[model samples]
Target chain A: MTGYLVAIATLVGIRALLALGLNVQWGFTGLVNLGVVAFFGVGAYTAGLLAVAGVALPAAWAAAIVASALAGALLATVALRLREDYLAIVTLGFGEVLRLFLLNEAWLTRGANGITGIPRPLRSWFPAHYDLFYLGLVLGCVALIYLALERLRRSPFGRALRAIREDETVATVAGKNIVRFKVQAFVIGAAVAGLAGILFGHYLAYIEPNMFVPQETLFVWLALILGGSGNNRGAILGAVVLLGLLEGSRFAKDVIPFLTGVRLAAAQQMLVGLLLVVLMIKRPEGLLPERAP
Target chain B: MAEPLLAVRDVVKRFGGVEALAGCSLDVAAGSITGLIGPNGAGKTTLFNVVSGLTAPEAGRIALGGARIDGRPGHAIARLGLARTFQIPRPLARMTVLENLLVYAPDQAGERLRGLVSRPKTIARQEASIRARANEILRFMELAPLASDPAGTLSGGQKKLLELARALMGDPRIILLDEPGAGVNPTLMRSLVARIRELHARGVTFLLIEHDMDLVTELCDPVIVLAEGRRLVEGPFAEVRRDPRVLEAYLGVPA
Candidate 1:
């Protein structure tokens, strides 16, 4: 039970970080970045690849962030020049390409059999602990990232990003480089997802190419939209709540034998999709509307 | 005193075979308040679009500070010291008034990723300067009390003021005001006109579009009229007001 709880906590924490990034990009900038998983996957793979190669934990995590950011910058440079609909198509394709590369690139990524034995952070520094130690490491990082996001949410740059989202033409007339600002927002968002990916890798001690699926990207968007597109606090809470409903439904299947295995997975995804649709219908703004500061 | 800061040379533009502008040209004298006047469908707004690069001319050229900028993007033209206000105010509805100004304020430190990380203090200082400057501009437009308020919360007249203040943030050499008095109350209109006059007095060149003939007569020195996107005449307001073509365009000919 303790291990299960840790797993849930770690998953929610990482997902919260991803949701926050979406809130900034889609919620604030009106950019529909359909390929968020690409960056998150890159970060996880970068960390995983580095850690298994005998790199230190901190350095691996740092490399993951930088690598993810660089990838995000490249993606932004290409994607931002296209119209919004075309951008969506290109990004979706880009994500599939990233997955295919991870699956086939045996030399670097070990292909389908993901790298395992990711070293736990702060393991050597503090020995013989479980809840306190693991929670302190994972949740603490989550908390720190959340606080930083809040700080940025209230900053001038964040405001400009929202402005561009609301009306690109007016922002341009206001002397804002609309494309430049949006690309910056996209890059920053990807970098955050990368950080989350690295955290996830260390927690699992295992990484697989198939693990970073498009479904995970959709889940992050679900959390962002469900919590409240414009609200960061809601984003964190949404991630937790969505995960609870998803994993909790699994325990329900144990009570009912018919809903087992593949059927359960389909049901889980369908429920989320329906929930997203219902949420949009009920309160398109979000579960928690971001209050004007 | 000085050569006109901006010169339009035989500008021609069209929209789907509708000659929105037909060989129209005008000179905006340096630091002087110039007015563009015409009735509805007279291509007054179209001429504004040509100058702002929202619509490029099919022929002719635009010069700012003696350099051609005929086909540049609106933002590029803005960065080149030519700023304009729209007929409709487009304030980033979600952001506060102060934030709207910061996006346009001079960023000597630049907005590089390193500047965000390494020169944090520099960014903060630049932000502070913009806030102070935005407040000053807002106060000048009698909008200081609403500086912290969301720009969308302001009244119609106030939004126009925001539009003007937004242009002022760039510290441009020339500003084109499109229908500054439209939909605003008389009291607010007077205030807006006063602000424009004040900015003009401070050497901000203006090419104003106004339906309020009284305000135009009061504020404008030399008025340029556009009818079907072609220049009709350029002279004193009263002369243009009495010009037979101007009267014929506005009131129509004998039955």
Candidate 2:
């Protein structure tokens, strides 16, 4: 039971990191990045490939971050010219294209077989309680990221992003380089997502293109909207609640017995949809609305 | 005279088949409050948009301080010491009045991500000084009481004041104010006029697009009138207002 709880907590921490990244892009900057999973997959694949090639874990993680940041910058440079809805469509398409690339490039990504035996950091030190140690590491990362993001939220950089989000024309006339700020925000968010991916891929000791479907992006969005879009604490809370809803539904099969695995997955999605509907009606600002500073 | 602060020569901008700005040319002398008055669709706002880099002109030359700025982006034009306000005030609604002003402070080290990390001390000091200046501007604009309140909570006139205050924060060499008197109550209008005069006295140049003839006559020096996307006449408000062409443009009567 302890191990199960620790695993759930670890997953929650990982998801929280992703949600935080999304919050920076969507919440603070008002960028509609529907291809979040592209950066996630990039990070996972980069780290996984590097690890499999016998690179140091830190170096591999760093490479993953740089790779994802560059990918984000490239996408923003190309697609930010298209505003709002077009941007959403383009990013969504970008994610699918990256996923297809990963699937077809068997030479690099090992095709559909995926990478396995990705080494965990400090595994030798906590062989007996490796899960607990990993949980500690994940939580540490979450805390660090949360604090950093909060500092950013209160900084001039964050203020400019919020201004751009509210009114781009106003921000532009006030001397903000709209494209520059947007690209920087994207790069930072993608780098954070990449870090989360490195942790996740290493935690599972395996990663595949299948792990980063468009549905995964939806889950992070749900978590962000559930917790509160702009509030960092709300983002973390949303991830915890979202993971709870998903993982708790596993026990529903035992209670209802008629729910098979496929049906159970369907039920979980419906549960999310229903909860979102209720959330939208009850507290559209989210579970923890952004507080005015 | 001594090289105008802003010079637009024969700029042309088209929207679909319609020409919004057809060979419009004007000059704003340094340290002067220049008024641009025109009838509906006379392209006063469009001309402002083109000069401020919000819209690109197909044919024209624009120079700010004698440097060509016709094709530059809006933010780049802004950074080159030009700032503008929208016709309908576009305040950063979700932010506080103070924050709205703070966001307009140019060249803050804290505005960069790397500066936040590499020069924490410099960022902190710069932020403190910027905050102090923003507060001073807010007080000058009589918005000190609403400093912490969201800009969206303000009345229409207050938003206008906030908009002007935000533009002032950038300390631009010249400001393009789009209809400063529109939608403002008379009491607020008097205060707004007073502020503009005070700033003008401080050597800040202004090119205002206004429908309020009284405000223009009281505040403007050399007024430029537009008729059908081209300059109708240019002179003092007394002379421009009396021009047969200006009357024809405003009343749609043959000059």
Candidate 3:
């Protein structure tokens, strides 16, 4: 039970990191990125493939960050000319295309069989103390990212992003390089998502194309919005609450034997959907509204 | 005997079937508060748009300080020492009044991503100066009391003042104000006018677009009038008010 609890905490930490990435893009800069999972998948695949090929974990991690950021920059340049809703559609399509590519590319990604036996760092040093060690490591990463984002939130750079989010024309007249800033923001968020992906892939010791579906991106968005879009702590809080609700539903199956498998899964999803609707109707700004700078 | 600080030459802008700016040209002399006036559809704002790089012209050349800026982006034009304010006053609504001003400070070290982390001392020093400068500007505009308030919470006139203060933060050599007096109250309007006069006296050039003829007459010398997307008359407000063409443009017949 203790091991299981630690594993759940680790999952929550990973989700928190994902939520933070979305918070930076959708919350801070108001860039509606629907292809967040695509960046995550790129990072996971890049790191996984490199690790499989005898590359060191540190080197693979760095490469994964670069690859995902490049992907984000490419997407921004190609689709950012289309504003708002149109941009959302383009990004959504990009995620679908990326997942399909990964699914079909048997030679590189092993098709749907998925990559297994992915190495975990420091797993051998503390064999009995593995889960706690990993939990501590993941929490440390989260702390670093949280601190960095908090610093950025209070900086002049963050103010400019909010300024751009409010009115691009006004930001332009005030001498902000809108395109440059937008691309930079997209890349930064993508890099963070990539780091989260690396952590998730190593922890799972396996990664499949199916793991990065649009539904996964939707969950991250839900977490960020539920916590509070612009507030970093809200992003983390939303992830914890969301994960608790999701994992807590496992007991529903034990309590009611009839609610099993697909039925139980469908019920959980419906609950989440209903929660989103209620939140949108009552507290659209989320539980912790964005703080004014 | 001196070159105009800003010049727009024969700019043409068409929207589908309607021409908003057709062969419009004007020049603003350095250190002068030039007024721009026109009827509802005389293309005053359109010309400002073309000059400020908000809207690309079909045919025209816009120059600021002898350098062509029409084809450049809005921020590029701003960096070249040209700044503008929207008639509707689009403040960074979520930010505090001080943040709104600080956000527009050109080329701040902290604005760079690396600079934010790499040079903390330099960023802190720069931020201190910006905060000090913002507070001074707030006091000068009589907005000191509301400096900590969200810009969205300010009254309409205060928003206008904040908008002007934002442009001033850019330290632009030339400013294009689109109807600064339109929605402001009388007392606020008087203070706004005084602020403009003070800025003008300090050698900041202004090209103002206004429907308030009273303001034009009082503060403007060398007022430029646009009628049907073309320069109709250009002279002192006193002389332009008497021109048959100007009167015909405004009143639909010679006065």
Candidate 4:
């Protein structure tokens, strides 16, 4: 039971980190980035490949973050000028393209077979309580990220982003380089998402193109909106609750023997969909709405 | 006199088949409140857009403080001490009145990432001064009581006042006011006029677009008239008001 709880907690921590990144893009900066999975895949593949090549964990993590940040900067440079709907389409296309590249690049990503035996740092050191240690590490990182993001949201840089989000023309006339700030937000958010991917790849100990789907991006968005859009703390909490709903439904099959795994999975998805629809209709600002700066 | 602070020369802008700005030219004298007036579709806002770098004119130059600024971006022009307010008053709506004011404070050291984390004391000191200045501006605009209120909650006239207050935060040398008195109540309009007069007295130049003839006649020194995207006349408001061309521009001649 403790091991199962720890696994759920670890997944929640990872999702929280990803949702925080999306919050910075969609909530604070008003950038509609629908290609978060692209950055996630970049981080996971780069770090996992480096690990397979015998690189140290810290260096692999650093390289992965840089790769994802560069990818984000490139995307922003090309598509930040496109307004909301067009940007969404462009980013959605980017995620699929990156996944296709990962799937086709057998030389690096090992194609459909994927990369296995991706070592987790200190896994041998804590064999008896590995899940607990991993959960602690993931939660620790989530807390640190939360603090850093809160400080950023209260700082002038964050204020400038919010200004651009609320009124680009006003921000421009007030001497804010809207494009520069948008790119900055995108890079930072992507870097954070990359960090999450590094943790996620190690936690799974294997990665493939199938794991980094557009559906993963949708899950993070659902968590962010369910929790609250602008509040970082809300983002973290949202992840825990939404993931609880997802993983908890699996246990329902155990209690009711008549329900098969496939039937339960479909039922769980429908419930989550219904919840999202209700949330959008009733509280579009989210559970924790963005506060006045 | 002293090289007009803002000079727009023969600026032309077209949208598809329609020419929005047809070779419009005008000069705003330094340290004076100049008025720009025109009938609807006369390209008054388009001229503002051209001068402010929101729209690039297809033909001609805009020089601010005697340096060509036509092709630059809006933020670049803003950094060169030119600021403008929108006709609809775009405030950072989710922010408080004070935060809205502080966002426009020019070149804060705290705005940079490294400066925010590494130079904590310096950022705090700079932020303190910016807060002080923003509060001071709020007080000047009679909005001190609403400093903590979200900007979007303010009434339309109050939003306009907040807009004007925010423009002052950037230490701009010249401010372009778009329809400042258009939707304001009489008492607030008087206060707006008084504030403009006070700022002008302190050597802040203004170029205002106003439809209120009373405001143009009472506050403007020289008025520039645009009729069908062309300059109709230029002189004191009273003289231009008497011009037959200006009269025909506003009230079309009987067919």
Off-target runs (Cα >4 Å) in candidate 4 are: A81-84, A256-258
Clashing pairs for model 4 are none
Categorize the docking of model 1.
acceptable
For model 2 the local lDDT of residue A250 reads 92
lDDT of 2 by residue, A126-221 (tens): 869899999999999999999999999999999999999999888888889999999899888999898888889999998878888999899999
- Looking at model 2, give its docking quality level: high
Q: Distance from true position, residue B239, model 3, in Å?
A: 2.0
Comparing 2 and 3 on lDDT, the stronger one: 2
Error of 3 at A43 (Å): 1.1
Once fitted onto the true fold, the runs of candidate 3 whose alpha carbons sit more than 4 angstroms away are A82-86, A256-258
Superposed by TM-score, candidate 2 places the C-alpha of residue A93 at a distance from the truth, in angstroms, of: 1.6
lDDT of 1 by residue, B21-114 (tens): 7887788899778889987888888877777777678899889989998987777888888888889888777777776776777553535555
List clashing residue pairs in candidate 1.
none
lDDT for model 3, please.
0.89
* Predicted structure 4, TM vs. truth: 0.98
Pairs with backbone N, CA or C atoms under 3 Å apart (clashes), candidate 3:
none
Candidate 4 lDDT over B1-255, as tens digits, reads: 579999888888998888888888889999989999989999988888888888788998889989999989999999999988989888788889999998998897777877888998988898999999999999999999999999989999999999899999988999999999989999999999999999999999999999999999889988999988888899999899888888888889822
Q: Which stretches of candidate 1 lie over 4 Å from their true place?
A: A119-127, A130-132, A254-266, B12-19, B39-43, B53-59, B108-112, B247-255
- What is the TM-score of candidate 1? 0.89
What tens digits encode model 3's per-residue C-alpha lDDT throughout B69-188?
887888888888888888998988888998889888888888799898789999999899989998999999999999888888999999999989988987789888999998899999
Worst 10 residues of 1 chain B by lDDT: B106-115
Candidate whose DockQ is highest: 2
Question: How many clashes show up per model?
Answer: 0, 0, 0, 0
